[model samples]
Target chain A: MEFDKGLIGGSTVLLILSLLEETDRYGYEIIRELESRSDRAFQLKEGTLYPILHKLENDGYVESYKAKGERGRDRKYYKITRNGKRQLAKEKEQWEKFSMSVNKVIGGELYATD
Target chain B: MPLTKVDKFLEDVLSHIKFPFVKDDISFELESHILEKIDYYMEQGYDSEKAEELSIRDMGDAKEIGILLNKQHNPFLGWLLKITNGMMIFFIILNIYFAGIPFISSLFSKNPINTIPKEDIVYKIDINDDKIKKIQITLNNGETFTETEFYEDLFLFAWEVDNEEQGRYFNNIKGYDSNNNVIFQDEY
Candidate 1:
């Protein structure tokens, strides 16, 4: 199912950072990995990814370098920095707490006994 | 080479970005991404033109992406930095013009006072009376200056002498006519 744009927007940075945590990835690689991991549910607009990547770079959370890809073509690869890893950890904790609280509210089991 | 649809799309996106330095890199990256997508689609049995069209379509609205990219670049910060750089250059030029060259020239001269040619030096005592047509003054430098050169040198001499020494400095001045007859002496 397609998610709301606003809903997906808040978590994109966390998702991107998590992907970059494993290894360096270029723009297309990031998008493909996101889609594959989410089972094609998160079809991010390819153009919008650049602004987020560029923003992450400007904030010093990520750094980019040009390197040859599998096709022997030069590609801009983004690598998460130390700061980005810390940020990802924080976001993950927050998401876990938030989602648990949300599940509790919507699960309707908290007041089921009463 | 003639412009392709992809080139037009890149141009449309890049035009909104005010910062020039980052545009080329952004264009190259985005073009590469689109080309890769087109290749992916062509492998899935789509024709070249169809794959190109689909690839561009999946990138989303060009104007929206451009505006978002512009926000990341922050044109305001870029312009502020540029303006500050320009102001710094202007101040450097102003300093060189007003102070640096004059200081350097002064260093090359042996005596600063003698830097002015002897003929350019003049001392003047103004006679406010309308009847006084010709007046001359002899300075400590043994230079005699007539009324004709008085106006130009008046400001130069006024600040050099204090009020207490004004009368003593003017004691050597004598007024005379075209025939060289002394009209007034030590009366000024």
Candidate 2:
């Protein structure tokens, strides 16, 4: 099923941070990995992904460095910072709480009592 | 390989990025992304021409990407430039206000100021109440002239007047005795 763009947009930072926590990835690698991991459901457009990456880099949550690719051209890679790790942990906690509450509502168990 | 299509694509994308210092790195990154996507397509057995076409198409609109990149590279510059322009306009208006008011007032105030000339004025007047001292007096506006060589009562002082007092001004006159008692007074 296709997800709402808003949902994907909100989760994008979290997903990017989580991916970078394991190993550094360049821009195209991140896009492909996200697609593969989500079974090709999270098809982030090139225009959308780059601006967020630049914003994350500018904000100090991620940093990038250039390394030559197999084709002898520069590939920019991004890695999460210590600050990004903390931000990820906080986001994870908030996501767990939010999802649990959302599940209760979806399951029809949550209702207004008063 | 001629990069004609890629060059056109990049030109379109970079058109949105206003700052020159930021252009090269952003252009490189995006171009590299396209080339990598092309390589992926080629690994799937597509020819170079088709791969380049597909990669550029997959990257979506250049104008859209340019807007995003432009925002990232030079944040707030457009707004700051506008604010700076507005302030310059305000300062120009203020300069005009400071420079124009005196000139406008001079243009509107047309009446020439009247002045008393030193040679045409009665520079000194000495009047005494002595019984035998003769005195000449003039009224600023009256046609009658009065000259007094008086004995008493007014002290019935004989007086003379003349036309030369036309533009001169006087508002008060008084007489006092040896005891400093006010004996006479008049005002016009």
Best by TM-score: 1
The lDDT for every candidate, in the order shown, is 0.81, 0.74
User: Across residues A1-114, which tens digit of lDDT does each residue of candidate 1 receive?
Assistant: 778898789899999999999999999999999999999889988999999999999888999999998879999999999999999999888877767777679785454333
lDDT of 2 by residue, A1-114 (tens): 568889898889999999999999888888899989999899877656888898888778999999986768878999999989998998888877777778777774453221
Give the DockQ-based CAPRI class for model 1: medium
Chain A TM-scores, per candidate, are 0.92, 0.89
Number of the top lDDT candidate:
1
Candidate 1 lDDT over B1-188, as tens digits, reads: 23297998999999999998789999999999999999999999998888888999999989999999999888788778889999999999999999998898667544433555665444433456444556766655455656533332231232233345543344367767566677776633
| CAPRI class assigned to model 2 | acceptable
Give Cα distance to truth, residue B109, candidate 2, Å.
72
Model 1 misplaced regions, further than 4 Å = A108-114, B1-3, B79-188
Clashing pairs in 1: none
